[model samples]
Target chain A: MKNALLSIEDTVALIASRAILFVSGPEHLLRSLPRGNWIGGTTSYFMTPEGGASREDRLFCTTFDDAVDARMAILPPNGLSGLIEHRFAHGFTCIVTPAFSTTLQRYAVDGPALPGLYNQPVFGWVAGVHLDRVGQDVPMVFDGATGAASADGLAALWVALPETAEVDLDIVNLFAPGDGESITFPEGGFDVTNCLIGGVPTNLAHYIVARGVDTTLPLVADYAGAMVNVSFQTVDAENGRVRFYAPVVPGTIYRLARTVADYGAAYAEGAREGSAADMLSCNCILNYRYAELEGRPTGGFVGPVTFGEFAYILLNQTLSRLSVRHALAA
Target chain B: MPDGGLLPSVDDQLWARLLTGELDPDIKTLATRLIITRLRIEVAKDSTVLPTAVQELRRFFVENKFAHRDLAAITGF
Candidate 1:
């Protein structure tokens, strides 16, 4: 079975036919389908059979067979991780979370506790806007748990994992931090109006000017061996304040990494080594844009062009994939 | 970092489709292509993504008699 971006008629037939489905595409497009076996999120880009790039209101869906037992859940942001852990604690074959942007985009660290925190392989994308801000482009989620739909909520689809299934979760990242200067924040978090430098909280914009650090380079934080990225939004030298893509978390230690990522190089290496057989991927927006991947191919990747990626952890500038294979019956 | 090797998956034309029958507002798509100024992340493994496994998926939905009832339909309240 393959994951093809369907034509309009085919998409309708697939939805009407009733098949186990997980959908990702432009929010406006997915919203049109009858909510039956399908649950959708929004995105315009995908790595389909046509290589690594396409932007349209097309669906990137995966249909499952009869042997798999599937269940859905609608998790409020309040206790999402716990809900997932509770359901999939015994483990699942596949876990998909096509959630609203509010749940996925608001936090840089992606909240203190997230479902991806679990060791299991999680696959998903952030539902996006493609219509009127009031109705059409509104980000949404369809809770398989309740068989309902809404905005600013989480929809999780869990498939029954085989007793002896060999599940492999993989994330393809292109950059790593180099030995660079250690940058720590103050006891009190620095606001957009200022920054903390050398134990003294000062004007953030001024600090960047004085240091001459490339404001474009994201501030990387090494936490418990995981690399968490903090991207800058605006650095107003006149106002002497700097902003970030997401708010800088409190008490989080950061380091300014001297990173020179080669997307061409990384993509090449991944193409040579990576596999897309029975895999679903959610690629990072950063990777697509930064790597200048438009019209370029990442070999065999096919999934959503997402704002962020989850590989048992919220990851930026990386491609996350989930692979499930049955163990040979012994 | 995931260590598994990534292989190719054939594109399934079944699950996701382009619904032309439905109408959509004339809204502009989100232009977030410029967000990334530089690209970098810790790469330690080969990303292994599997092809779509639709045989069993299609079978599951077919036998289960798949039908979605909205909140109103389910509750009848």
Candidate 2:
């Protein structure tokens, strides 16, 4: 039998359980959790092994804005160092949960209205497990940026052991354009890439070229229109334990399109426009990046289903666009 | 200043006065706004029932005035 460590499933389950507890309980549930901007737009709960009753031990519950502000407020004159020191002494653990709202739709050339679908509010939740023992006062550097403030933000769990932990990171670019095609730019003040994606006829070739750079290219900006997808991942290896974290569920696919006539229109109206590309919505997975960079490890990895869906959508869109462009140019 | 005893109607202001010492100016402002908003909502629900509640609340505030008036001056409102 294969040796089983902490599977992504186990981590997600823990996060989900904590999230449920937070949402179902008192309003003050968010006040006590580890505070930060990444935890924004989400509810959070923090508990320790020795904490008292749920009500008494529960730390805090608040909106993302409040959470960020609170976290910012606690920073000391030397930045994150003070906060890290406090965390070392407290034996802290935290859970962050996010609530997303929007609909994803896919378009087909044959139909006036393309086949559409909606994804319900998917919550991104993660648990924090502290591996370090309390009382060893270690000198740690504190970078002020909200995401880079702590080790947990950069990777999963900071184990303060007798010896320092060594970790390796792999950053894989998942999108790129196909071979032999080139997109040249018309020199001037114009942002060629943005122009092509945003609706400038002269910039079409540039968009194609930009897509060529990434093996995981997005759908052709002209054919598919504009899309936004969030992508991020972090792997933390420490003390014989490897923790995988996906800020957003990689398998959860969300199709999104521009709802407004133009970029300005969309911004003014505060919504989307055009047709959806699977996985076009902001990938919650990036939250893991924010957490990891901040030295906080949001416990749990993105489930396989979500990861598969994200990868498929990313690959399909890029390859499909390249194929179409190749045929059109030919 | 009696511990845990119900103060007379005239002494209701003592609660606010006392609370002022324990809370900072910003906290005082937030607490006041919270209390006022709650009172306003209650008053809106039943205007007739609010006068008593408002009087009691005001009295509590007056009696419990902070040691430093600077703390009471901070108004989130």
Candidate 3:
């Protein structure tokens, strides 16, 4: 089976029992398991059918039928971005870790680029929950060795599937245009380091104040015909900068739209297009808390509630998922 | 200076010494800072008990010696 949301018992049982395995859940429980055929990050949220919104410390797992050989690597903070494209240049990869993680903190600003992963279906999430890991668990990707999640490290799980299996990456965005106003950075980029708009490199907080844009609402852009978006993280009034969970691509034109849509319909259709066969999926914490998805499901997609997501880039306020299906007829 | 075990009470000694009758502006400021630092330490220990801490401060004020009027105007003293 490509994917299944196994119970706590079944997950622990299935780990070493399977030929190849990858898992996600809380740090303490994941660390408790014996070292075997699995790797996971710390998180308690998942997407299930009752509109899939819940903090379940259970595992969403993947098990390949045939004995699969995998190459694993630890991408340190400095080199993670460059390393991904090179390592998984040809194979399928499953990356898991928490956000503001030292390994990921650089990318929070660097706008990490993987040389040739545009077509490679690289999927993962920035995993962690409200700082129970503060004094206890270290928010991290662990492999059972008294690991520290924050300061210590992060992990990338790479698995090469069978020839028949092809990967498809999907994003479930539930926002339609509301109060549309086309926006852009006319001259340069707006990042944590230099927030600019209309060619003036000022802090994002300044620009937002100057423009009176609601920082809570996301900005969407038309990449060809597809509407891609960037979500806000913190409005650093002190720093005069606004940090986003994802990067605002340097030269793209964006529009400040009041997002208005239904989550249930968005995830259901997106997941179905991938044949409703997701091995890994994560909804953003923004969508979870702000969208009030605590007990409700998002149609039929389910996984962890992540701090951020990577559908080849850092994403916010979106559910990004992956599946391995047979190549559709050409 | 104390010969016995009774160290002079910080509150009692301070009020007895200066800034009493019509409270000078400078000494009042120093007194305000002294009370604030001690209150801040207790609050910082755990902010969850903030309301209870405030009540405790009010109780201490009620039990203590002569001082400024308008306890309602006092934000945290």
lDDT of 1 by residue, A187-291 (tens): 222246644554666776787888897755667764433455666656789877776654465545576655546655654454444366346666766666666
Docking quality (DockQ) for each candidate: 0.02, 0.01, 0.01
TM-score of each: 0.66, 0.20, 0.68
| Tens digits of lDDT, candidate 3, A159-210 | 6665556655657776644554445543333355453444455565776777
**lDDT tens string, model 2, A1-330?**
001112234423433433211111222222222322323221122211221112322222222211111122123222322323323211111122111100111111111111110000112122221113112321121121133322122111111111121111111122222233322223211122222222233333343344442312222111111132322121121221111121111112122111222322222122122111211121122222222212221111111011111211221211010000011222
Q: Write the per-residue lDDT of candidate 2 for residues B1-77, one digit (tens) a residue.
A: 32213333434443333233322243322124333333343444455755565464454344432212322343222
lDDT score, residue A286, model 2?
Answer: 28
What are the Cα lDDT values of the candidates? 0.51, 0.23, 0.57
How much DockQ does model 3 earn? 0.01
Best by lDDT: 3
> Model 3: how far is A24 from its true place, Å?
1.6
Candidate 2's interface RMSD, please? 22.9
- Of the true interface contacts, each candidate retains a share of 0.00, 0.00, 0.00
**TM-score of model 2 (CA atoms):** 0.20
True contacts kept of 3: 0.00
